[model samples]
Target: MVANNTGPKIQQEKATVSVMIYLYCHQNHHTPRNQLCNECHDLLNYAMARLTMCRFGEHKTTCERCPKHCYRKDYKQKIKQVMRYAGPRMIIHHPIMAFRHIYKNLLSK
Candidate 1:
């Protein structure tokens, strides 16, 4: 199968994930918005790159639930922490994107 390029949907989801992680880091780690600490910035950059490189494209599931593992172990742990801390908060802070993410994952399953 030809690999699909990342599309707007994936881009939007990546943006939402970045925002969620940023919010979590800001609150818990006291990082500034203009400058995420090096680790968090690296994580965000890595996640965005992974999202862009994802083979499943539009059919991609939530990374946590996905059968295909993409992130390295250390990055995976960091992302898990970010998601765990910010996932629920996304419902409040980014209702539409959050609901869409949940709905997409459920449907994909």
Candidate 2:
């Protein structure tokens, strides 16, 4: 699916899963897919599910390991800091609360 150019430059899309898949395929090509154990499959599947991106065509998402900015439909918790940020971000959307949090955490004695 061609992505509708939403801004000045045709937004570049990338997927983390695609990268993982690429490596997975590369590695698997050497060591047949059938030989891959359940652990490997599960780990790869979960990683792919998060990093795969379809923001352009097919709307699939890619992995975050890639050096691109695509909406990752995968779990944010895959990274520790992302998980931590999401919680506080939701809990304190109010400007006043945000200010309080900043002062409390950063500037207080």
Top candidate, metric lDDT: 1
**In model 2, what is the error at residue 81, expressed in angstroms?**
19
Q: Model 1 lDDT vs. the true structure?
A: 0.84
lDDT of 1 by residue, 12-90 (tens): 7788889887888887889786558888889999998888888888777788678899899999999989999998998
| Maximum-TM-score candidate | 1
Query: Candidate 2 lDDT, tens digit per residue, 1-109?
Result: 5343333111212122223333344354454633544544454565443333224333322222323444333433333333243324424433443343344344322
Clashing pairs in 1: none
- lDDT: worst 10-residue window of model 1: 1-10
- Note the Cα lDDT for every prediction shown: 0.84, 0.36
Worst 10 residues of 2 by lDDT: 8-17
RMSD of 2: 14.6
Which portions of model 2 miss their true places by more than 4 Å?
A: 1-35, 52-109
